[model samples]
Target: MMGGARVRQEEPSVQKEANSWVFARSFRSEEEAVRLANDTPYGLANAVYSVDAARLARVASQLKSGIVWENCSQVLFPSTPFGGKKGKASGFGFEQGLAGLKEFLAEKTVVGTSRPSYNWQIYKKA
Candidate 1:
């Protein structure tokens, strides 16, 4: 763990309310930070600060967490899928745009019928 104080500083207010949880602080470099983030047994969300877009992309790819916030904290949109890696159980499918809407619905496919029916399946199941 980076440090209790550091995690507290980087985490959001809601996250702070979870007494059972521990937050890790921001890393100096994307590499160092990602290393620490990935090292943890639980792969959750990771926040990165990078003024450079290229650097952010590089770091985002390396992070073990499912969600990576560049120069920001937390996932903001419902359409944006949020989940965790490693042992942390968050989610398993995308949650944004049409893809996200699909997650909440079921699709049925009818074949060889008088009228053609579209397939409605959950995003993850599909």
Candidate 2:
């Protein structure tokens, strides 16, 4: 239970990332919640509270925010790293923790599974 939370996201107070404002609203369904949440330029952090683990995973995956907490809120760890995904709302690529150090380092990806090594026909069901 926190203090007063703004009801609308469009409010000048909420438009900026205040880190305290909450979009206090009730949705008829979960889809509506996800829809309304994704329709924004800011992708900082989001929290999903549900007893159903599957539902939590589904909603977390659908959310475009940089961080999605399930059954928890504001739980941060230096090892886990904290950062935003899109837009200037999250400082673009300002990460905290090991990830922050990695961001400055160079990295590359090498794909070795372009072609299957084993025969697919063997594993295929008749």
Candidate 3:
């Protein structure tokens, strides 16, 4: 409920294990929904349905959830960055993006190989 209102409902045993869950028929505005989603202690995931692209983007940014779906309820691509915030459980690190690919792999940052080695040595002294 909004504005600190409380309601009573029978929840399943599995739900008790969850941190919290909210089911609302509709939100007055996307901003309100995003605020409610972000106010939770958990940042697991969020689902949003909106026809306006601008509103969707604003809501997406405001959500503290690790993954947000706009007009859909799933992550479709493997190249998108996905992770949970506020210590919510996540499936894995950046899944299919460059960041995700580099998680398990080692990347070397070589600074001087392409340039003159003497130039790097000179800069190292400074």
Candidate 4:
């Protein structure tokens, strides 16, 4: 609705895939905004702008995306885990999290009973 009355709209600055950004007017309510944002196939990232921190946090949690930025553009850090939800856009695994660290380590499970019991098969009557 922001870009005239056309149903489909894209940012005027966008000229190619490298410059992709969909700019649309806000819906009636926050729920509608979340619904429209999550309807996409790719849950790569999403940005929410709001003056109220609580409301911004609430909306961010409802989004289907793995990465959510509030009142700011996308910024990456070495410590923060980077990845998306289930979809083609989502990578194999997180880049900086416990899960990501696990990807580089070997997994092993140790099993044992608190009390040891001998097998009766050795003295079983045949």
Candidate 5:
């Protein structure tokens, strides 16, 4: 229904600071989708639902959000940094993971999350 839609959305998802409101819209291609997503100043977190891993990686890379979930949303972990990026949408630093460690300490930060703890297959098509 959205044809070269306006970046400004009146919906609660765009209006409210923290919300679970899921925004759904139609797009002609991935490029359009990325454009629509990055249009927002809030770069907190976003999810990409795709069967193609390559496409997921590509789209996730383009998203300006601080956290990008592949085929998953709101998946929290102690080893992962939970925060956002941008003007008003972001804060000083992340609250978890290596970022959090860096916040409390001064010398050096060491955390092992290079390999995600969760299974990638969970998001994949069975």
Candidate 6:
């Protein structure tokens, strides 16, 4: 409910346990919604619900969280890559998918010449 530049302010809050809910004042615009959501120190995950697909996509893109759910929450899939920020201090990198596999893998490069007589000295001029 927006009228002119008036902004309704409510108490900020957080819940420690599961299934607990905290309520805050409704946002007047999309920019306000993104700002309020990102005001928190934590940005692990977030979710948005809307009948408009384009609006949902636009909002989801601007959210600060690493993972975002559209019209759904916490629907984890094995094939989907999951991880927090690069320096999240979460004790792990991505957990699933090809990107996750690369975290624990060590890659090495190898080279060889197949010529019968090969002169490997490049600095010596003939």
Residue-level lDDT tens digits of model 2 in 1-126: 122333565756545666677655666789988986776667888899999999999999999877899999899886676778755366656477877788898888865555565545557555
Give TM-scores for every candidate, taking all chains together and pairing residue i with residue i: 0.51, 0.69, 0.56, 0.68, 0.67, 0.63
Which candidate leads the pack in lDDT?
Answer: 5
Specify the highest-TM-score model's number: 2
Q: Whole-model Cα lDDT per candidate?
A: 0.62, 0.74, 0.60, 0.67, 0.75, 0.66
Worst 10 residues of 3 by lDDT: 8-17
Instruction: Give the TM-score comparing model 1 with the true structure, all chains together.
Output: 0.51
lDDT of 4 by residue, 28-116 (tens): 78897888667655676778899999999999999987789898867877777766786635556577767568668889997766543
Q: What's the best-to-worst order under TM-score?
A: 2, 4, 5, 6, 3, 1
What are the RMSD figures for all models against the true structure? Answer: 10.2, 8.7, 5.8, 5.2, 16.1, 5.9
Off by over 4 Å in 6: 1-25, 87-91, 106-126
Residue 37 lDDT (model 3): 59
Worst 10 residues of 5 by lDDT: 1-10
Give a tens-digit lDDT track for model 3, residues 1-126: 322323222324212325354454345666666665565445666787778999889888888776789898756577776656646544455555766677789878865455565563545543
Candidate 1 vs candidate 5: which has greater lDDT? 5
lDDT of 1 by residue, 20-121 (tens): 554556556657666656654455577777688998899889987767888887657865656556455455655666666877899998665454344453
Name the runs in model 3 displaced over 4 angstroms.
1-22, 25-29, 86-92, 106-108, 113-126
Model 6 scores a C-alpha lDDT of: 0.66
Clashes of each: 7, 0, 0, 0, 0, 0
Cα lDDT over the full model 4: 0.67
lDDT of 1: 0.62
